[model samples]
Target: MDRTRFFVRVAAVYALIGAFMGSHMAGGGGLELSAIHAHILVVGWLSMFAFAVYYKLFNIPKNSKLSVIHVWSSFIGVFGLTVGMWLYYTRPIEGMQTFNTIFFIVGGTILLIAFVVFAIMAFVHGKFISEE
Candidate 1:
């Protein structure tokens, strides 16, 4: 899947979205989006970019199942978390507060699992670092 490329591309998209959100908040004279904006940039862009570099720097096998889990989980986790945050805060729909809350909490939990998987990946693949 060329995880390095995938992560970098997704990270770029997140960076753009975060920037746009930041600008919107600034120009609109409101900081309501501050938490979400920071998280989008940090988790989506920064963390994803770091993972891309991990793939680039390590000698991990391309066909490893761990990489597959890590990548997909990271992608899903980030998207879910960000969108869930948006929905939770905006509540753009009517009488959907329960759904929004559940979505937000689940998204965050998934993201945490992703992080744990990331740590495990490091341990399992750390041996490959020297091979790089």
Candidate 2:
């Protein structure tokens, strides 16, 4: 699938998951899980997905290595962040505290890099405008 479609699909899935989790939280579900769900849905799903879709729809060069890097970094970052948070909350390991912190920080940094790369790609590639 194209990047735009891929991003949209990811965003939609995240939104749906968020909604389900919200309902569960409202019904007095676990607070830690709820917080993790919110983080994944908001940062992982909504924000990252929106940025990816915007970059693609704006016609950023598909051939750019930066694009590939952005996609892979984002996927890995989100996966790591989610898994780290799950482990941290469930197991509550003292040593893993530092490890989880590193995961979150690295993941966030990678995501930020993705956004920067996307913005640069978009600017360099230019937007698609219709002739008047």
Candidate No. with top TM-score? 1
Which structure among the candidates has the greatest lDDT?
Answer: 1
User: Tens digit of lDDT per residue, candidate 2, span 3-109?
Assistant: 66766676777677778777787788556588678877987688767766566556556786877877777667666766676677766776777777777677767
Per-model tally of clashing residue pairs = 0, 0
lDDT of 2: 0.70
TM-score for every candidate vs. truth?
0.95, 0.73
Residue 71: error of model 2 in Å?
1.7
CA lDDT of each prediction against the hidden true structure: 0.91, 0.70
Error of 2 at 13 (Å): 2.9
TM-score of 2: 0.73
